[model samples]
Target: MKIATPNDRLKQIMKERNLRQVDVVKMSEYYQRELGVKLTKSNISQYVKGTSNPDNKKIQLLAKTLKVSEGWLSGYDVKKELVVSKSELSNHFDKIFQSDKIKLDLDFANQKYENQEHKLTFLALLENFDKLEEDKRKNLLHYSDVLLESTYQKDEYNIVATMFDNSMEPTYSEGDRLMVSFGFDFKFGEDYLIEYKEDILIRRLFFENYKILLVPLNDKHPTTTIILPLKDHFKVIGKIIGKIKTSP
Candidate 1:
């Protein structure tokens, strides 16, 4: 459909596309009620004679029926190109990935092992998943004590984690994730991802005055904070330096 006499352009599109005037009515009502109308003549003439003119909305509807742009119907679509091939899309994707860098986001304590090996090794952790029986989660607590015995300072626990639970919402939402560094400097209002009571995995952590508070990301959810009284057993295991969400 072009901006010539509406009758002439309508006839031209009908001839070129093997479409009937009634087909235009049907197409105009796409995904809508069926239209039953005569089509011998006077279809496009109603608009051409200035007896009636389509508003912007009707023009858009008519253009959609003709598989053309509303701009084309109004004589403005001539400058636009509307189609692109799959190869063009592939080329576009290639251009962006060419400069994308994949870096290892490791904990500050593990900064000594920043090379690609860390990524490979960290991913190796996944291989052990299947071997970790469901009931073994509690047993893993034993490993924590043994792992903590190393006393390598915060720098040695080179891993970061985010709490995985819906206990926090809105403020922390169920899926809101965070990044943590074992050596992350404490800030008054900032939160930390950490473990409480060896079993409670939670997300909100803040420092006020001299007390460290493991607040829930969402106050609406159940949350509690423990004050460190210089007891290693009652301490933050890791700083939630980052999060990789697996589900909502």
Candidate 2:
């Protein structure tokens, strides 16, 4: 009997839910924002196309978010209702991989860092963040033991995202880099990074009884006052706290 692979099972589940690729992308982002797990579009494509597999932690989260059992999702055993442990998954990857060169390189780098007296500087790589796959990146970081710089101090819940449009001109310009804080207190007539209808926008939020209004500051831009159901289509990603204007 031919048993289904994890990829096959994922496709089946997605099919059952009538989910598209873009829907999966949204689900992955939702998972990351709520759970701190990075699941990108690349990761979803890889998983569905059999190019890669998620770790046990990701596997569990995937099952929970997709409304499936771990065993069924991974195609381990149809009757077994269990989740694979992290250690077991790590051991599985190690055994399956033919080359250990990447692992060896990481080990050597770790030793060098341990013996060095210089302070290590860590900066968030801002380029192409939307294009990165969370699961693959997490696995690489785990395997390499890379430690990211802490943002727990004043910048806690803060992220830097570049603005590509001039919709909020005078307040925000094209090519400006914004320092967005996810922990900001929401208020009426405030500019925010909003998620609406599966699109990300930087606009002003207005209060209404049954609907919320997304208004642009620039009148010349001709943005229609988008009236959306208060809680359904509107999501606040973060508030724009600061900006770094690019020199013309």
Candidate 3:
């Protein structure tokens, strides 16, 4: 199969949206007006004509104006919206906008896609872990390069999360990191990162007659354990695989 270049994909998306090159020019102007960045028509034309490539910021602007996801234009089958930070944009700008002839090596791109398709993509939280409920923790701080071999689905096998507090104690303190295996099924008396009362917590879980018990390891705390029904409010995010301390 003939793979499309980024510019080719851009052209295709524009056509799908019934947009002309002039429309893209207008959108570039709009992006400049809104972000205080120079989105030149020349640059946009270069991107469309395969003469140059836009950086992440420009690509984001174009994607927004074109009403498409970045993944779609890059030919990744994705549904979620992607957010690129200004710092990341600057880095991409330095790399891509340097040369006039932007070559999209389809072979390398295809190889990278194939390599990462089965790779486990573990994500860290963008916001405070305590503030985010299990379902609300949608924003990813970053994607780890580490990959693990597993037959389970991609989401199920990906694991590990940074510690938010000293809740787990001795096992994992505040600022420590926990490696987890989402693919590993839970067992009684096992440590896991779980969601209870909308909070992501690390605790030992025990199963009993349609109920789950969350027990903390810290003996200083009076609350020995928390018991809740095995229902919506309770869920196991991942089983603890390993732990890393931030400092001595």
Better model by lDDT: candidate 1 vs candidate 2: 2
Whole-structure CA lDDT of model 2: 0.57
Model 1 lDDT-worst window of ten: 97-106
Order the candidates by lDDT, highest first.
Answer: 2, 3, 1
Clashing residue pairs, candidate 2? Answer: none
Clash totals for all models, in order?
8, 0, 0
Cα-based lDDT at residue 171, candidate 2: 78
- Candidate 1 C-alpha error for residue 172, in Å: 3.9
What local lDDT score does residue 213 receive in model 3, on the 0 to 100 scale?
69
**Model 2: how far residue 117 lies from native, Å:** 17
**TM-score of candidate 2 versus the correct structure, residues matched by position:** 0.36
lDDT of 1: 0.43
Q: Model 2: runs farther than 4 Å from truth? A: 1-157, 223-232, 245-248
Candidate 1 structure quality by residue, lDDT tens digits, 24-77: 564444212212223222545565445656556555556545545456566542
lDDT of 3: 0.53
Model 3 reaches what TM-score against the true structure? Answer: 0.36
TM-score of each: 0.30, 0.36, 0.36
